[model samples]
Target: MHSLRNTRLPFKVSLSLLSLSLILPIQTSGLLFKPLTLPPSHPLSLQSYQPLTSATTTTTITTNNTTPSPLTLSTNMTLFYPAETAPHKATILGFPSTHAVPRDLLNQTRNEIMDLAVVISEFEPVRVHVRPEDESLARRILNERFQKLEDINNNNNNNNNNRTKKAKAKRFNLLNRRTRDNNSKEDDIPQYHLDRITFHPCPTNHPWVRDTAPVYVLDKSNPAHRIAIDFGFCEWGGKNLREINVRNEPLGLEADGEDERSPVSSRKGYAAPDNRHWENARFAKRVLEREFDLDEQAENNEIKVERVVSPLRLEGGALEVDGEGTFLATESSIICPHRNPSSSLTTREAIESHLRALLGVTKIIWFPGRKGLDITDCHVDGEVKFIEPGLVVQNKPHPKTGKAEMEIYKEIKEILGRETDAQGRKIRVVELEAADPDLVGWGGDYDEGGEEELEKEQEEAAGTYVNFYFVNGGLIVPAFGDQKRDRKAVETLRGLISPERKIRQVYVSALPLMGGVVHCVTQQVI
Candidate 1:
C-alpha cells in the first residue's frame, strides 16, 4: 500500500499545478516530472492480498506545486418569468416622495414591515438589498464637503460655513455683553445656524421611484441579456396638492447640482430639478449599456434597451404583471385625458398594442377604476395583483361604503370575461374585500393656510390600505391601526405568498393626503 501511494504522487502534483496555472500567470513546466513506480509486496501476494482491518497507515509527499488557484465567482444567471407565473426573482419597488406622508410615517412603514431579505428568497434564494433615498443624499453631502474644503484652501479662507460663523462672532462681540445676553434670551426668535455639514436638498416629494426607475427584464431567447423598460412617469397628472410635488424631478439631480455650484461662494444652492420622461428613458438606456455590455447595434440581437413609444402615458404604479403573459391594468389609467389626450386608438386598442410591444403581453385583464377619486387617476395595482397565473387577488369595496366600488368590480368581471390575450385566452378574475371598512382613510394630512383650516381638511381626507407596495421579499401594505381590518389584510396576503415570505403591514396615515395609498405611491420594476 505504501509503494502504491508513492506511484500516484507525481500525477496528483501535476494535476494541482495544472489547475493553478489556469488561474495565475504561472509556468507549469517545473511541476511536471516522470511518473513514479512502486513494486508489489511479495508477502501480500503470498497472503492472497488479504486486506487487514486494523492496519493504520499514513503517507506524506512533498512537491513544488503547493499553492492552489484562486476560485472565480461567476455572475448570477438571470432567470426569466413566464409572465403567467409569480415572479421567480427580485421584485422592484418605487417609493413615492413628497406629500405621500411625513418622514416619520414613511420610516415607520419601512421599519414595521417590508422585510427585504424574505422577498428576494421567493424569486431567488438570496437577500434583496434596498437602495433608499438617504444613500443618494449622503453621497451628495460628502462631495460638497470636499469641494468646500478645496475652495477654502485655494482662497486662503473664504468658505461659506466658516465665513458665516466668523460674521456672527464679529456681530456678537460688538454688542454690549448685557444686550447680547438679552438677545440670546429671546428663545422664540428663530436663529439661523450654519450647518457645517453640507446636505443635498431633498428632491420633489414624488417618492414613486419604481415608476421612474427602469424595469429590468431578462430576454427569454438569450438568458445572458437583460432589457430595462423605462416607463414614462408623470407627477400623477398634477393631482397632488402637497408642497413636495415637483413635476418631473429625478433622483440624484439635487446632489449633482449642489456639487457643481459649491465652488461659487456667492451662489446659493438650489433644490434638485425634476427629470423629464425622456431624460429618464435616456438614463435607462445608458444604464443598460454599462451594466449589460449591450452595443448600439445589439438591437438586432444580443441585448438592447429599446424605448416603446405609447400614445397612452403610464407610470409603473398603474400596472402589474402576473409572471405569465397576462397583466392587469385599469382603463382609467390608460384612457384618462390626463395621460393620453389625442391618441388614435380607442382606449382598448391602445392598451393592447402598448402591452404587446413593450411587455410582449399576449393578454390583458381590465377592471373598472374610479375616476377623479384618487391621484393615480385609476391604476389597477391599487386594486389587484396576480398571485399566480389564472389566479388574482383584487381589492374589493367595503360592505357599507363601497357601493360604487362594488358596481365597478362587477363591470370589471364582465370586461375580463370578454377579454382575451394576443394568444386568445380568457383571463380568470377573483375579488377580495378591503381588510377593514372602518379603518379607511385614517392617515391623511393636508396644509390649509393655518391650524384651523388644517383641522377642517383632516375631517375630509381619510386614508385606505388598499394602496400598498409589494417589495422584493415582503408586502409593504398600509395599516390604519384598525386592528380587525389590518389583521385581515395581513392574513389574506400571507395566505397568498409562501410561508417563507413575510407580509409587512406599514401604517400609511400620510399617504391619503397625497391622494393615494401604498400602491399609488410606488412603482414595481419587473
Candidate 2:
C-alpha cells in the first residue's frame, strides 16, 4: 500500500487527436449522429500497459468448433466479451442534457460528469457524447473550467480544495492538452497524446451509457474488428419508477427456488417510459451507425466489424463478463417479464443459451436481484466485480446498511467464496468496505438530499466502492469525502491489482441521489 502511486497528469500532448478527427472521412450531416465533431483530449499512452492494439489477452477462452447463435435473429458469429480490466482503446460518456436529466438534478449531474470526464481523460482518450443542444455548454465547461492554467505552468503541490463563503471551491488540476504553452519546464511528458477528451454528437435520454451503450465484443481470430451487441436497453424495463406500472408476480425471479420477493419499485411509484427513454434504448444502434460501416465492411473480404440486435432486453451494467468463458448476471434485470417478455426467453436456461451464443459464455452465474429496487432493477454490476476468472472484488456490508440490503451483500459474498469459476478454480473474493455513515450522509444533514434520499441511497448504493471503473492503467473510483474508508479502498485495490495500475479517486456527490457512481456513467471501447 505504501508503494502505491496515484494517477499523474500528463504534462504534454500532441495534435494526433486533432488529426484523428480531421483526417477520418465522416458521415453526412443528415444522419442523426454524424461521426465525432471534436478532437479527443489525448490518448493515455501508458508505458506499463500496451496502447490500444488488436492483440488479445494472454488468457484464452476455448470453445467447441461449432459456432453458436445467441438469438434466433442471428449470423453464426461467436462474440468474445472482454473483462473490464482489459486495456481500453477509448472511454465514452454521455453529456447531461436538459431533455434527459431532471431540472433539479441537471446542474449536479453535469458538474459530476465534467469532473469525471476530466479525470478519466488523464488515463485514456474520452469520447463524450453530447446532445447537439448541449454541445455549446460542453465546450464552455471544458474550456473554461477544465482548461485551467493553460498558459501558466503551475506544477506546485497546491492540489487541495479551498473553502470560501462556506462553499468549498474544488481546484481540479485538469492540465489541458500538452497542447498548451511550450514554455512549461516539465520534461517527463507522455510520449503521445492519446488521452484526449473530445465531444461527439449523440443524444442520450440518460447520461448513464453503461446501460444504453452497446456491449462490445470481438471475434477471436481478428480482435480489431469490434462487434456491438445491442441488448435493447428498455429504460431498465420499459417502465420507470415514476410510472404507474405494477406487478402482481413476485419479481418474476428466484434463487435456487428459494425466497421469492415482490417488486419493491411497484410499492414506491412509477414513471412511464417517455420519448427520451426510448431514445436511450435506440442509442446503441445510433452509435453503431455513426461509428461503423457494417454494410460496406460485410461486402469486403477484410475483417468486418458489425453489430447484432439481441432479443434479450439487457443493459451493459446488468451483465458481467470474465474474458474467460464465464458470465455473471442477475435474474431480476434479465429474466423479468418487462425485459424478456418474449416467450422464447422466459426460462433461465433459455436466457443462458442466448448468452452463451452471444458472448461465448460457457458458464452462467445467476443472482436473484431485487426488481423495482431501483431504475436498473438491481444490476449485478452494483454487487460484484470479477477482477479475473477466479478473483473478485465485493463490498462488505456497510455499518448502516439495512437488514435486507446487508443480507444481499452477505449472500453475494457467501456464494462467491464457495463457488468455483469456469476454470474449476476456487474463487478469491476481496471485500471493500464503504465509507462511514457520517461521511456518506447516512443520517447527517448533507446539502444534497434529505432523509428520503439517504434511505434510497443506502439501499441501492450499499457497496459503491466496488463500482469503481477500470481504465487502461488505472481505475476511476468514487470518493465520498471519507478520508479513512476511501483511502483504504484505494490502498486495497492497489495491492490486489498490477503495480503499473494507478489509483485515482474523485469526489462524487450527485450520482448517489440516482443510486450510481462513476461506473454507472462510463463505458469502455473494445
What value of lDDT does candidate 2 attain over all alpha carbons?
A: 0.56
lDDT of 1 at 81: 30
| Candidate 2 deviant stretches above 4 angstroms | 1-76, 148-195, 241-277, 293-304, 441-463
Model 2 Cα displacement at 488 (Å)? 0.9
Cα deviation at 379, candidate 1, in Å, is 0.7
TM-score per model over all chains: 0.52, 0.70
lDDT per residue for candidate 1 within 1-526, as digits (tens), equals 0000001010111101100000001122332111111122211011212222222231111112122222111123222334423343333332223233344345422322132222222333221122345446333433443343233333333333554433222221110011112212322211111232122232322334444444555655565454555443433432322222224222222223322111100011111122221232232233323322213344433323422222234666566776667777777666654443323323576456545555655566666676655455556765666665555666665565445556765776677668764445565665556544333333211111221111112222233344555544445556543546656666666666655444544443333333444554343333
Displacement of residue 206 (Cα, Å) in model 2 is 0.4
Note the Cα lDDT for every prediction shown.
Answer: 0.38, 0.56
lDDT of 2 at 519: 84
